[model samples]
Target: MNQVVASAPGKLYIAGEYAVVEPGHPAILVAVDQFLTVKVSHSETVGTIHSSHYSNIPLQWRRENGKMIVDERENPFHYLLAAIDYTERYVKECKKELSIYHLGVESELDSSSGLKYGLGSSAAVTVATVRALLKYYDLDITDDLVFKLSVLAHLSVKSNGSFGDIAAATYTGWLAYSSFDREWVREKLNTHSITALIELDWPAFMVEQLSPPEELKLLIGWTGSPASTTSLVDQVRAKREAKEENYQFFLQESKSCVEKMIRAFRDKDLSAIQKEIRQNRLLLKNMSESTRVPIETSALQTLCDFAEQYNGAAKSSGAGGGDCGIALFDRKASLLDLVSKWEEHDITLLPLQVYTRS
Candidate 1:
């Protein structure tokens, strides 16, 4: 093939945010309409990446001793380079010759102001790039492979993450996801065994596809301030590691709230959904106060409070220093009124819908 194009949707965690980092814990995620797209075409010269998200100048890279290398100054695109490197390594392990290709990546996952909405844009781009390269090389492009390769590439760039974003990007639509064994993966990564990692039985990591409840309205409101998930997660982790009693209590409560929310969703019980959403928000709020991690900012808390006045539910979606907060409502709720109230606080209502596999 002369060219290949692939895209992956961004994700939002409805519940079970920081707790999902623990192995065996579960989280509910939904793929949003926003997507990161990657286009790969054959190139005669060195491989380059063209992305408006990065720079006007196309970043050039080359292979040295079977490893991909880019100029030190162009480290912004390291995630893209890491995806290419991991895919190449997988191809080599299979004893197959993969042709080089130029990659063009573009994303609609950010706000008009160029601030990310914390919609897992990095994971989306990583998954899209891996899929594009696999298609370009005529390799197998199963969702399983996409998830694993994306996780590997993601870990290559950022040392620690739950990789729930990779799972959501790989499998579109609403999903109930259980955490994978990060410790096992860490051991394999420490040994630099890409082949072994690829051959592992990863299907044990559960991802059950689901659908949104009927008449349930979902809305995302951007706080106009971006949050660094890595930093927030690290802060939460440190607080937890310090054996904070309140932190432990928050984890248990949050986990139970997520379970109830998932059950309510599956049963299509709107009242139960609203109740659990409020419970989850309260748990997060208490955790924020105890840990001092700012899981819910004053702006997000006000939004949630306003949403509750209409019998709707709202809370911070991800790591939540700022970024976006998600609100869910029944058919009777007036979205226009909610939007107007949010606008008064300078919050922008994002035009996001649930994304599903075609």
Candidate 2:
């Protein structure tokens, strides 16, 4: 049997975290070299799904009257199952016959101990599955369509995510992204056909490619603590509901800061980029203080402090609390100084590079 393989890279946020949760707010992100790969092949009878990240034994399922039926309790494959079901629906919408398939996944986004690195694994896996299946079934695949399909499947499983990770996985590179109004998409999903939905213009959704300054060097460090982005976002949202004015202030300020950063990237100005990084870090700090959500854990603070002490600009990479922090410095700077300081605090330097589909 012939199998088609496809992969999607993970991502890290450079700036605009909590604010990006709101519709139309911009954030900077980059795709990392780590990837989740999916392999899809034809199956005449029972469809089997296997994942290196989820289970040692392969999960089995079959279609019933064209609907996928798997144990709902097998939560580890929830995202994968959702991706398959939605992609099949899209195939059926295109007047194609549904067929059984064996799908398997291999992932490098997590450590051997299964510790997540906050590298957007869910989005990467979903994208990889969709891409592999689309190729296996001989369908036309575009980055935008793959992104929309991935977003649709992801939203079906979890509704609150900004889906910026989906965009980052779909378009592998540095990006300035503004989230689409998910509420609008959710309302439309109930009434529109999947084909029509994919074709419609999503309001406030924008993805622009960016080029980093040649002199800029990015550094990533893991604090050896995993953070739940979903939970952190929920906590921040719960707290911010009571302080609407302050939340709005944060959103506006983040928008301005990210826009300037985007311009700096476009202009290839390393100094301006570092300045905006510093400003964005302060904005996140203020937001965390007001919301009482520890966006920056003590370990992450140490990581950033060491970077700053070594003449670099730094901040937490994602929803913070734990996971990883990122720093940027001029290529001419001595990284050994910051490395030694980070070592004193048990911070592990991650050897990750920007991933682009050349």
Candidate 3:
């Protein structure tokens, strides 16, 4: 009997987000402090994995709307089948069969706020699944191929994604990936290289010593309004089609801003970093669609107003309108002062992290 324990973390894009959705858009993503872990061990049965956390979740191979259906709710049997099929394929490829297995998933992050920051929980699951399956079957899977397969599995789960999450989770460090058409390239950087980048991962790219830790803070203001990502992405696409020139201008400017941001990181220029963040957010605010919800209700306007008051910068995280928005402060700003000001609101101020993933 063999078993494997594997985990994949969530990712955050400090710069590129909506632009990544456009064709040929290059972006960088860092695996963040969140993740889902899956453990697979050999068991007696050929089918059926007992999943304790989620409801009747199953993975299967079948036809849905004329397409191969990999999973559907209540498909525990399907997950077992998927594990067997994947394991058998790996074994055959390796010219060996290590036998049957049992698998369970435990993603550390909670949905307590039901807040799906949309960092790739499913992609993390896919990464863990393939790794556990291959390890259990006694085969070596390359990280590149693992990433490719993970992306395929992700598309199988949801077709609209750009694969940013898969890229960040598969590789153990910060990644510079073009998610739109799946163009990926990675640069290894030790935590010292970008004092802001911190984590418990490989540090083989730059300076050997780590930068002194600084207390990072974020002031999050919730508008209590949320919107649909599908509709928002569609809206952006529509606007771009109608106003190609203006949109292209923003794209070029945003790309320049991102490049400068990368340089600011390398130079340790905090002011430059803040400048780029503000510039990029401005371009996105005017060019992109409304935060999916009208700014009035979405708190998009309110957050904007607050950012001005605090002398900081703010930007929406996900498809917009609601969910969460990130408010980046100048490194010298007082975190406690910001917190005291925000204490009366329902908003949550989370400790911020800038890290190269492992």
Give the top-scoring candidate (TM-score): 2
In what order do the candidates fall by TM-score, top score first?
2, 1, 3
For model 1, what is the C-alpha lDDT against the true structure?
0.82
- Candidate 1 lDDT over residue span 306-330, tens digit each: 7878778888998899988988888
Locate the minimum summed-lDDT window of 10 residues in model 2: 67-76
Distance from true position, residue 222, model 2, in Å?
Answer: 0.5
List the candidate 2 regions with Cα displacement exceeding 4 Å: none
What is the C-alpha lDDT profile of model 2 across 1-358, one tens digit per residue?
A: 5989999999999998988888899999999999999998889989889997988888888889988778777657878888987888899998888888889999999988999999999999999999998898889999988999999998899757788898899998999999998889999999998889999999999999899988989999999999999999999889998898999999999999999999999999989999999999999999999999998999999999999998899999989999999999999998897898898899999999999888
Instruction: List the candidate 3 regions with Cα displacement exceeding 4 Å.
Output: 50-53, 56-92, 96-99, 113-115, 172-175, 180-231, 289-297, 300-308, 351-358
The runs of at least 3 residues in candidate 1 whose Cα sits more than 4 Å from the true structure, single-residue gaps closed, are 189-196, 202-204
Tens-digit lDDT track of model 3 for 77-107: 3333443444344455556744445567776
In angstroms, give how far residue 169 of model 1 lies from its true place: 1.2
Q: lDDT of each structure?
A: 0.82, 0.91, 0.55
Q: Give candidate 2's error at residue 123 in angstroms.
A: 0.6
* Model 3 CA lDDT for position 42: 59
For candidate 2, the lDDT comes to 0.91
